[model samples]
Target: MAKTFASTGDTAEKTITFAEIGEGLYAFTAEGDPNTGVIVGDDSVMVIDAQATPVMARKVIERVRTVTDKPIRYVVLSHYHAVRVLGASAYGADEILASEATRSLIVERGKEDWESELGRFPRLFQAAESVPGLTWPTMTFPTRMTVWLGKRRVDLIHLGRGHTAGDTVAWVPDSRVMFSGDLVEYHSACYCGDAHFADWPKTLDTLAAYNPRALVPGRGDALDSPKMVADGIALTRDFLTTLYDSVSESAARGLTLKQAFDRSREVMDPKFSKFAIYEHCQPFNVARAYDEARGLDHPRIWTAERDREMWEALQG
Candidate 1:
């Protein structure tokens, strides 16, 4: 292969930052790694987007202990991705929650995704053996569900699909804070291996309608103000549109997937090359864009074998 496969070369540990974006709401971010959200209520706590491994999740739990003694009663999944859901067991929460669509995706591709991501990002899965099989949600809702942590109201809503087919956001109406899984990234590359390019922007629109005062994105630093939130959303939209448009144009011209990848680089590199995981995400992003442009409604499952095959075909 011409380049390292995915993030296998990235082995250095990142500085973990647990920032309070709202009143009693925290965002556990590790540079450009996947982020986790904490919502502390009058009674119990709710955690959003568990990390990739049980050991990694303990890092979040450690931070959660510093603030309040409230037990983490619920763990909410933003999507069905292995990197986001496999750490659920570490929380030991009373209930694990997810959108119905997310649960369905897990049932269909959970095992494959776990294997594929472990191969792609070895550093994220610090203790692979510790992941006790696929993480399943004990509770699920179709579109929206509300949970109360004492007086705090958390609305888990499926705005639409962007990062994946089953993306959900946890909204705190009292504080106007939202925990957006991978739907809105800040100065970080959006991983679109299972993305719906055409449907992503509309989902962003629905998320924007809420006008969150503070937002904890799926990756990068947390947005602590409305301006930052707006910028984050716009940046994500721009990234998606630029990628899809370039790939769609290439497809329209009957270009091969490799050719389309080169075309996409020419357009995206100048604008987003400096972003976190930009290179790691580009091949998969372009492949999905190409598939979507050519009328594939659902994303193809990515197994460990398929991951290497696609990487070699494109990145080689």
Candidate 2:
């Protein structure tokens, strides 16, 4: 697969690319960094996800201003992650929407996650001083909801918990375009530090059932056809499977987490070495996989302290 990864500030200004993926719909992706999507309708606009901080969000706003003057009526939280949801207030959105599980996760571990992420990815959280605090969604859904911006229909579906319990994918059926949050990443690393690996593939099946003609992945460029869409989903699935299998095998041999990280890296680096944040992700991915392989179903909360401990343990 062809790939390009731009590692920079939260905005990743030089690498940011916005493409008109569907009619009146746009995808703003920053190389292999986090991305934001826009759906402009006759009456209002909906932003798929806000960036890390208000300062970062301003870049998205500036881009939106270039295309439409309509008010941003809603900010959709694809999942409850610091990088995805913290800049919400900047949108001045009437409603910030999320799934019930995401809301619960926010209450359960949002603060620690905010601290942990801020400590680890200082670059992504640029303008960290501007974050008001952990962002909470004012509105939420249990399974599915279709909201209409005038006549355009955007279906928000909670297919199943994979990356996180409350992950949601925004699908625009008429246009055959889907904005798959972190649920889909084109050629980037999957931050499975908090993922449900066993359940993730099933969720991918649900996403594939839609057969989107075009997809705005969690990161990377927007895929423009069914062939590429299938390739993207398949690649993401392979990534999850490879990480999990390597750790499960390592743990079976009674190896340490660091050992598992080393083994996994040896196997995956040749293929995934160039993926964005590949270095930062390997240790954490192995730790989560080790936990899950030992029959731990849910990912343990990650605190700033835990982040440091894990990084130190596996910083090879």
| TM-scores vs. true structure, each candidate | 0.99, 0.95
After best superposition, candidate 1 residue 315: deviation in angstroms?
1.5
Q: Say which candidate scores most in lDDT.
A: 1
For residue 98, model 1's alpha carbon misses the true position, in angstroms, by: 0.4
Candidate 1 lDDT over residue span 189-233, tens digit each: 999999998899999999999999999999999999999999999
Where does candidate 2 stray beyond 4 Å? 1-14
Q: List the residue pairs that clash in candidate 1.
A: none
lDDT of 2 at 110: 97
Candidate 1 clash figure, as a count: 0
Cα deviation at 69, candidate 1, in Å, is 0.9
The sequence of per-residue lDDT tens digits that candidate 2 reaches over residues 1-316 is 2121122233334478878988888999887878999999889999998999999999999999999999999999999989999999899999999999999999999999898887777788878999998898888889999989989899999999898888999998789899999999888988888999899999999999999999988888888889999999998998999889889999999998888998998889988888877776777788888999999988899998998777776772
TM-score of 2: 0.95
